[model samples]
Target: MNDDLHLRIILISPPADVDFGLQSGSGNKYKTVQKQVSGNGDLLFVLSVKIKNDKDGNIDFAGPFVQGSKGERFIYIDIGTYAGNPESEWGRRLKIPLRDIPVSVIEKLQPDNKLILETRVPGMGKDGGPNCATVKPFEGWHAVPV
Candidate 1:
């Protein structure tokens, strides 16, 4: 992977059943325009995510949160979501808002050049499937080249 390429992932929560009434297509499609990052070489990959609640409920969009190393490791920008109910298993799902996640390779990795990005619902099973036994604050992991 080229160090100059930037990777970004953003999660968006659509209105309940409203679908924004846009084109009917993939469930994980993004409606926003592609964004570019300057002074970084070039934008290589961009991923837009749509997180939906299995049950009828509301998800809040808080903003963007940063995860992983500050300079060396890849950065995860969370769009933010409303806090789910602590008592209800189905209601505890975190909602990520719609936006562009910006990723840039500012430095070089120590040993490896390839990075892997992974995401999962915290306290859930290997698959992201919903289950009452699972807990909230789903966990997501992202690995990127330095």
Candidate 2:
């Protein structure tokens, strides 16, 4: 392949309540993972899903490939963290780099599709506690509000 593909996978858009004004990667958390697919069917996984902030978090990923028998294919990404609330700022925005994802996976995600976003907060059950938020992005990415 002469050129590489790039995509901004969006997990969530920021709510109106956030004060995410003029910040770097100001909208959504994203990880820039990439794969270079050769015409001969070679694939390379470049990176893993990462958080947008300084905190430590982790995620998992599976193929940007085709399922031959069933004719079903998709990229699998799972992210979970104690998504802290956005008081002065937001925390733990996650991202999936489009270039890292195969076009096969991108085809599966369309607008208005309801997908599950797994989450846990340090104190979601209590009052005066921090809440979590959404993540998305492009190249030169940063974890920002969705």
Candidate 3:
């Protein structure tokens, strides 16, 4: 839980799995590459963390995101979808975009040593699936600078 990690938050377009087809059902086996991040659909913002040896550690899941005037703008994860399944690393990791994020919210966050999207024990990801992310933004995720 070191709080000095650097993360990069980027607004990304949820790419379609050219290999699995955009509508691939319960299973998304194809891996994604940076050059392949194109196409359209819901926006997904991801926290790109630098892990050991400078390898990029990806923090997916449409959990807590760019906060808004009303509250923290969190995204929803379709249960059992490609997002919920971490295997879809190359594509849709279920993250929310930052364009919709406000400047005020971004100012309140700090980075951590590593990437670990936090999940509460009594919450969805912990007990059941990432059920609608019903509990809203998973609480303990540290991100990189905006």
Candidate 4:
């Protein structure tokens, strides 16, 4: 495995003003992106390698992250549904763990590469399932040519 492999998680136009962050393996928290918003009216979360999965595949990530604890890796997506509505009240700030993403999808990523993602929040679909945020590599999603 390459030591510099990284994946960028970009949310394409979320439905609400949401905040995102990261919790490291040491139980330290860091505010990554405030009110996830891309210039094109979307949210972007760049994936960085915090710790390499050992033989145990213990994920040292927590708090709104998608990482695998097993041998496989994952991408975590956490969204804050501060819409102040009933449906949005219960599942507010859902911790979505994308455990099914194939490692090959991002295994070849280099420092300059990016993995564009598309998701359906508060709905059931690809990447994640019902009543949770879903994220999947955009069809034909590949490492950006460097």
- Best by the TM-score measure: 4
Computed on alpha carbons, the lDDT of every model, listed in order, comes to 0.26, 0.25, 0.29, 0.39
- Models, CA RMSD each: 16.3, 17.2, 14.3, 6.8
Error of 2 at 17 (Å): 3.4
Please name the candidate that would achieve the greatest lDDT relative to the true structure: 4
> What tens digits encode model 4's per-residue C-alpha lDDT throughout 2-93?
24344444454444433433322222342333334213355555554543445565323322343455534444443343322223322333
**How would you encode candidate 3's per-residue C-alpha lDDT over 30-74 as one tens digit per residue?**
322222222453223233321111124322212122222223333
lDDT of 3 at 26: 27
Cα-based TM-score, every candidate = 0.21, 0.21, 0.23, 0.46
Predict model 3's lDDT versus the native: 0.29
Instruction: Tell me how candidate 4 scores on lDDT.
Output: 0.39
Q: Which ten residues in a row have the lowest lDDT in candidate 2?
A: 65-74
Comparison by lDDT, 1 against 2, better one: 1
Ranking by lDDT: 4, 3, 1, 2
Candidate 2 residue lDDT tens string, 3-71: 222223332323323221111221245232231111222122222222121123212222232111122
For candidate 3, the 10 contiguous residues with the lowest summed lDDT are 18-27
Q: What is the lDDT for 103 in model 4? A: 56
Better of 2 and 4 by lDDT: 4
